[model samples]
Target: MPGMVALRYNPILKTFGERLLASGHAPKAVIGATMRKLVHMIYGIVRTGVPFRADFCSQKLDFQDGI
Candidate 1:
């Protein structure tokens, strides 16, 4: 399902899920969070009229101190 795909390929969700697992979160909780994330992503794409772009989706944000 989409949850499986997100776990395998969606970088943001994949990393988030892994971190939650490492922190001792339940597997079902992780999967549910990932599914919610996927839904939000789909909604954003639909609202913006932009095709799903894996490259864009996988980009990591760089945070600088003192914003």
Candidate 2:
């Protein structure tokens, strides 16, 4: 699951939703967006042959050359 955050109004969600709309996403597209993120996370684990670790963290440049 994503990092924890308290429920509160945030302009980013509106902005993101607007972008999704512009890209032809329907009102229920949030589910798809979330699923896509999950798929990416799973793909990352498989691509690197690594199991998920709670403390896992890396910068994009860190693996530019492939570990």
Write one digit per residue (lDDT tens) for candidate 1, span 1-67.
7887898887777876787787788898888877987898899999999898766734452221111
Candidate 1, residue 49: CA error in Å? 1.1
Candidate 2 ranges beyond 4 A from true positions: 1-27, 55-67
Model 1 reaches what TM-score against the true structure?
A: 0.71
After TM-score superposition, the amount by which residue 5's alpha carbon in candidate 1 deviates from its true location, in angstroms, is 1.8
Highest lDDT: which candidate? 1
Candidate 1: regions farther than 4 A off: 53-67
State the displacement of the C-alpha of residue 50, model 2, in Å, after optimal TM-score superposition: 1.0
What TM-score, computed on C-alpha atoms, does each candidate reach? 0.71, 0.39
lDDT per residue for candidate 2 within 1-67, as digits (tens), equals 2311100122333333345556676645644554454567679989999887533443332333211
